[model samples]
Target: MRRSIAVCTLALVTAVGCGKTEPTTPAAPASGSTSAAKPMHPAAATAMQFLQASAAGDLSKATGLLTPVAVEQLNKQGMTIAPLNVESPKFIMTRFLVTEENEAAVEFAMQFQIEGEQQEFHGCCVMKNIGADWRLAGVIIDPGNGMEPVVQNYEQELSPPTTNPANTVANPAGGQVPQTAQSPDVPQQR
Candidate 1:
């Protein structure tokens, strides 16, 4: 079941979105507020509900919050009905990484005890905003490997100023640009 969860998580990260959606930048959290002063966004709350239901061994409730695709992913990973064996789970934080009109990405951190040892899982989930409802489209969690899940970097991927090496101009400074072909804009040395 643990392996299935991890595998499903990996799959969901890359499989979240199917339609092109404009990204909405979340407001910066107020200084000194660990979880921010604002109420959780609906999409993020949906993800939290899913995690809570899973932790509490309520598979039906958890699945109810997931999109059809997410449920299919769980079924494919052999997690259709199995609930996570987590105890004393507590959400540490939740932040919206990408919030669009029809989709939102939520980054979350939670601590729980499993097999009598405390463990922390931190990752992101993408939620689809349906009419008057939010459903989890995908989820990706870090399984204690000490590396953050890549979903946390979605903002950078969607941000402007996307750089392509071929289009890059040589630095005016002494630093050499790493490229096989010189930029067309730069004068070729004789």
Candidate 2:
């Protein structure tokens, strides 16, 4: 009887032990998944949002993401940004440099198709942490196509000077006939 009781007790202990549950952590969501809308970094999220907004032709949304200085610079340059027809925009976060506790530079690569043309651009976005939010301070894009921002070439000749009769200065000779044409201004040396 004692042996049976001991066996039952062992069985109960084994059953209880077998029925015990172990703690588990949920798996992390895949990157870029909407259901898990968490981004790897704040600047990355901002950049991606800006690109998406621009691609969707949401100028208001896109401009809203830019810093005040960026908007002013764009305005100063008279830039007319056409809506991009981007497909499958991918953002790859690269090196991130923290200049200070509140400022950081995020480098990233963007790949997408614009008007059916495949395009890739590398750029950096300077971000400033503002009261628990990350704001884009500036953006620099390098298309890596040996192209640069269009600049007015002041060295290039504009146009031939227009002949303005009203602005023309009077001849210093003051209506005097040229020496070759008539008598010299001063007596010619014999």
Q: Which candidate leads the pack in TM-score?
A: 1
Lowest lDDT 10-residue stretch of candidate 2: 149-158
Q: Model 1: runs farther than 4 Å from truth?
A: 1-38, 71-81, 146-190
Q: Rate the local accuracy (lDDT) of all candidates.
A: 0.59, 0.51
The candidate 1 region of ten consecutive residues with least summed lDDT is 151-160
Query: Residue 181: error of model 1 in Å?
Result: 33
lDDT of 1 by residue, 117-136 (tens): 88777666767877899887
Model 2 clash pairs are: none
* Cα error of candidate 2 at position 23, Å: 29
